[model samples]
Structures are given as C-alpha cells and as structure tokens.
Target: MPEPDEICGVNIAFAVVGSKWKPTILWVLAGRPHRFAELRRAVGGISEKVLAAQLRELERDGVVCREAGAGFPLNVRYSLTPAGVTLDRLLEPLAEWGHQLQRGR
Candidate 1:
C-alpha cells in the first residue's frame, strides 16, 4: 500500500474510506451515535467480530469515536468525529453516482 503522503488526493481518500464495511459504518454513524448492536443491524450481514475490528480501525484512523459508559452491561456507542463528517461529505458525490447507475440514468 502506498503511504498516504505518497499518493494522490483521490487515492488518499480511498485509502481511508475504501473498505466494504468502513463506508457503511461511517454512513450509519453519520446519522447519529449508535450502539454496537444498532450498527450491526443497520449494516446488515456484518458479523460481530468483523464489526468490532472495523470500528477499531476507524477509531485508529481518527474517523470514528467510540464511547463506553461504566455500567453493569457496558453501553458502548460509536459516532463520527469531525474528520469523519468531512469524509461523509466527500463521499456524497460518489454515492450520487452510484444512485444514478442503479437507476440506469
């Protein structure tokens, strides 16, 4: 993989949000903070382990924020950081293109 600084701007963007699960995770979290189970349901077909791993990666990338409360059953939630919000905006055009393709327009 090319170092982010070595790549063009587009490639750098892809490097951050290119994964199959990462975009979905970001999109869902863009709506509002959600618990782990809510994210799993919103992003259907993702397994618990995979979701956990992806969330960890996103957190490391500074695009996702993970919060947990101190309680009997831990209440964990995920939300987009300001950087993640910017990424969500950047991806909007690509999403529109996908919609057009789906519509055959």
Candidate 2:
C-alpha cells in the first residue's frame, strides 16, 4: 500500500477542512458536544436544511458520532469522535493562521 505522502500532498487533507462551515462547526464542537439544534445555532447562518445535511455527512465521515438515547421523544446528541478530536488538533494551526490573516488586513 502506498503511503499518503506518496499518493498526495497535504492539499487533500485541506480539502476536507476546506468545506463550507465545517471549520466553524468543528470549532464549536471543540468546546463541547452539542445536539442538532445547538450545533445549528453555533454554526449560525447555515440553513436548517443544510445544517441537517452537513450533520449527516459529518457523522458518515466519522468526524462526529451520534448517540441516540432511549426516550419517548428520541434524544440524539453529537460529539466529536477520536478521529475528529485529532482533526481538531490539526485545525488549531489553521485557526491561528486565519487569525493572522485577519489581523494582517
């Protein structure tokens, strides 16, 4: 099997983080796990339809894990998985870079 460095440069990974609202969403979750509504609010400006779609996609991508609670009204919460935690660590520098860019302006 070829190593990642052989197959591609870091651009592929950036593409993952480059997604719209994903960076902001991840930042919010880094603070604390949030349910659907909470995530939507934190991500502010994302439409409901799009927010739901993004959450589903994030869960599928293993960035977020969904836990369903047993209850009359189904309760579901989303938290960063270990994989996501690692990604968050990687993103910290990106966040700093963004800060620098803003400051430079």
Candidate 3:
C-alpha cells in the first residue's frame, strides 16, 4: 500500500472533489467532453454560475480542459485532461465502494 503524504487523505480528496456538484460533473464528463450547458443539464440542479465556477476550478487543477467548438454558436466544450482521466479511473472503484456501503445499509 502506498503511504499518503498527508495523514488525512479523505480530507484532501474531499478538498479536490468536495463541492456539491463536482463528483457528478466528473462522472458525467467521464463518458466524453461536454459543453458548458451540457454539463449543467447532465449535472442537474446546479446553477449556471456555480457550474461555470466549478468548471474553471477543475480546469485550474488540471482536471478539465476548456476548448472551443465548431458551429454558429461557437461552442465551448470541456474534457477531462490526463490528470482527470486518471482520477476518473480511480473514482470508478470508489463509486462501487459507496454503492456497497449503501447495500450494507
């Protein structure tokens, strides 16, 4: 097992993804890159402003990429970066763990 640099990793993990809607955002975007509106739609219940801020934070943390898209509206899409890709891979099992805990309850 790898020893964590921080004594409390749960705190750190929460710091990264602890936002009300970030985990869902990451999960939805895991399938493919999404436009700003698309992410809001998929995430459900997040306000436009909050989603935009979270996306910016994700981009800053190297978790998401902001890219310009094609067409008339001049779309902007967000994709998981290499770091986010690795994080998504890690999150899958963590998701299962949460499900298992739900089952046990």
The order by descending lDDT is 1, 3, 2
lDDT of 2 by residue, 1-105 (tens): 768785674675565666888877878888898888988988899998987777787787788888998996888888888878889998898789989999999
User: Which model scores highest in lDDT?
Assistant: 1
Candidate 1: stretches off by over 4 Å: 1-7
Q: What are the per-residue Cα lDDT tens digits for candidate 3 across 1-105?
A: 546766476676677787878888888889999988878899999999999899988888888899996788788889998888888888889989999999999
Off by over 4 Å in 3: 4-11, 70-72
TM-scores of the models, in the given order?
0.84, 0.83, 0.85
Query: Per-residue lDDT for 1-105 in model 1, tens only?
Result: 866765787776787789999989999999999999989999999999999999998998899999998997889889999999999988889899999999995
Q: What is the Å distance of residue 45 in model 1 from its true position? A: 0.5
Question: What lDDT does each candidate get?
Answer: 0.91, 0.81, 0.85
Ranking by TM-score: 3, 1, 2
Q: Please identify which of the two predictions, 2 or 3, would achieve the higher TM-score against the true structure.
A: 3
Which residue pairs in candidate 2 collide?
none
Residues forming the 10-long window of minimal summed lDDT in candidate 1: 3-12
